[model samples]
Target: MSFAKAQDLLRLALMASTRHFGVSLEDIRAEFSVSHRTAQRMTDALELTFANVTKQTGSDRRSYWKVDDPTIAQLQPHQETAVEALEIASRRAKEEGRLRHAQALEDTRNGLMLRLSARDAKRAETDAEAVLEALGQVTRPGPRVPLNQKIADAVTEGLRGPFRLEIIYSGRSDQARTIEPYGLLLGPRSYLIAKQPDRGAELLNFRMDRIQSAKCLDEWFIPENGFSIENYAAQAFGAYHDPDQLKEVVWRFKPEAAERASEFRFHPKQTLQYQADGSLIVRFTAAGWLEMSWFLYEWGDAVEVIDPPELRDFVQGYQRADFPSLP
Candidate 1:
């Protein structure tokens, strides 16, 4: 492709990417059938020439490319409609008590809107309102312990400034705690990932709603020993973790649920294999057998624990019709 053609194709790709989120070099290479070197050149061009080319690093530790300036926003009408559909999905997620996904969709909508000119934002909001009204949709947040903004602010400030924090936790008593705030996870419930008073201890998740009060302390700290929020979050099935309990769990799905089981995403770090006999096997390493059991319970008898007998016993122990008296 000629330089002018490559630039034009890139501009169009960027316009779509700006509304959707961001584009990757792989996207450019596949779309334009260009070399990796050419894709890099396109990214450089977009960064240099665009007014608000910015990067957003999500909790998953992936960087999405975006153009964030209002003056130069270039979302087409169809792109606007697609984003509106996302708004609708956000509303549905909220209604279904999936607040984490609701918050994510809202954030994406806000990011796209932030890139629009003031007039455009107003116009688009009005248009979206009408569209949503026609759809007659509504939503609400999932069940969660009510959050205390003051506590949340203290935790956020500490993490942003890379400082230590002091907490007066009303757990079992009037306990004093100091921590290095790492990351905050907003889900059905919220948690603060931090390094606590003990040195060399693993990062722990503290329920924000449980803390009585929090203060940003002057003592400085940093994420040491190569800690990344993404890596830390990936170490568990859900929110609980203990390094000692980490295990490679394997489960085989009977032929009845094999196809569905194969399609399901068990964990971010997991592997799946289809047996010659038609069963499906899945495995992942994580530190939360108790938590994992909760999710696995829903699969019922369709799954068989192939490795780590402990988890299998835990599951079977709960598969009781009634409490039987022990002899």
Candidate 2:
């Protein structure tokens, strides 16, 4: 093989090893348009050259090849940031009970890290770690997921499914329901966002832990027309939403808290205005007054509600009797 052909075969062989289902000789031939003999030569070269590469024999005695180690391959400086990102994603997934995804991310991270030695790895790692540390300092941490393995798996599986799953949900008691899943959202917890045509056409959020059992139905359901998960999630102030009850909310922050409040993100679609008086005005339109109220409560006396009487009422409702009155 020419130098270029050798490089191409090495790249192909390395990728094949990452798959649990090893690539067959036919797979290489079909993908790279190489003949059976050429495919065998590439496979043999990979096994002989790389310590991590492996060959598995199928029941038919045909051999399959896979990349035993991707991380062992050297990483360029730009690749360091990509490695750092995958590490963060893996940590996030682990916190959210997505073990399979977390593990996969870690494996990828580990493989990348292996390619670097302490001497040549210094500068790129420092830059990437700095970015990750900044995000860790500012972002509010999500709650550790409380969902069981099976329920978590079901919710994950339903995301791409055209299947209506039969689920036994519990509130006052266990009751059966059929739902066509739209997507899932992860924040403080995980929710399976779906719709039930039997109940109403409106979409609903089901807490993953509350689902007693779920089974996929034989019948498949199509996703709603023009429905996008990104748009759906953007409509909520947080994880909760009252689709029809959305209202514009305004809050004024005192100078002491204005800087901090201005730096925070309360809603996906929110705007801020810094006043000449060093105060800040935060504005957003969304629903879930109770959830909104809970957030504003965190600001204490530093933040003042300026509009939407209902939100003020909800916040006022949480007040304790005999507390110091404010003007």
Candidate 3:
């Protein structure tokens, strides 16, 4: 096996040891299908770096290697669960023809799963296989690209300095344009927030999926003062957010829906008031009409747009047009 693959197996063994036997080297090596000598070498490598490895007396009266890092031990359960979820999601993405994204997610899931117990690893693989089988039947085909890492790196670069980017962007009308990038933003979806030379004064939001190609430019631009990504995202929904687009919206939910809505706060701007009928009146500011539409649609017939005639009209239009009609 490749050294990286072997190392990954070793790490999973180590993690499992911590959870089940307080880091027994013998147990770990056996789990990885490795010899005692190789397992000793692996433990030695970890000891050199973490300084947490030591010999301990087990119930069998044998001395075994152990890792005493409480923090790492605490994360074992969560790490295993997250790895399994990622594996399931990755397989689903693949069956849907999201080849690039699936590969990337699969790689990440494997890497993370290698830090979990053998039992968890086996469970994840089984679940992933099952999910893929189900996905094969129902997944809708779509144009998918592995854009998460690219967007994350680009955003990091932008946040570090005023990094410039050269991007081939596909617009709303499906027209492609080359543009110089400014800042990147994490909206409901990741967006390349930049100004196009042709579209002066308008900071355009380009969906990462629509970006055909991107290159970091030699030139850079300084970010304007008082502009924070967190603040920007808090005020907007999706990728079409602008500082000037904020507007208050009110909605009423049926009693059953109101009880559900009360359990979670949808937005920082959201305000909920209890009605006499045990329903809820929710008020929040939206960056655009698109966000309001999506919020309403998610609730089905449980919600009603109370104020803003435009929003109510828009919701009504979608209800009448989008749903199938019975003859």
Find the candidate with the highest TM-score and give its number.
1
- Identify the superior model by lDDT, candidate 1 or candidate 2: 2
Task: Order the candidates by lDDT, highest first.
Answer: 2, 1, 3
Which candidate ranks first by lDDT, i.e. highest? 2
Candidate 1, residues 159-247: lDDT per residue as tens digits? Answer: 88889999987677677799888887766667889888674666778888788899999988757778777777777777787787688
The lowest-lDDT stretch of 10 consecutive residues in candidate 3 is: 318-327
Itemize residue pairs with steric clashes in candidate 1: none
- 10 residues in a row with least lDDT, candidate 2: 318-327
Give the Å error, residue 154, model 3.
6.9
Off by over 4 Å in 2: 1-83, 110-143, 317-327
Candidate 2: clashing residue pairs, number: 3
Q: So what's the TM-score on candidate 3? A: 0.52
RMSD of 2: 12.6
On a 0 to 100 scale, what is the lDDT of residue 81 in model 3? 50
Q: Which stretches of candidate 1 lie over 4 Å from their true place?
A: 1-79, 82-123, 130-142, 198-200, 317-327
* Residue pairs in candidate 2 whose N, alpha carbon or C atoms collide under 3 angstroms: 17-66, 17-67, 71-111
Model 2 scores what on Cα lDDT?
Answer: 0.76
Per-residue lDDT of candidate 3, residues 189-253 (tens digit)? 45666667677756677777677666666667755667655666667654567555577778888
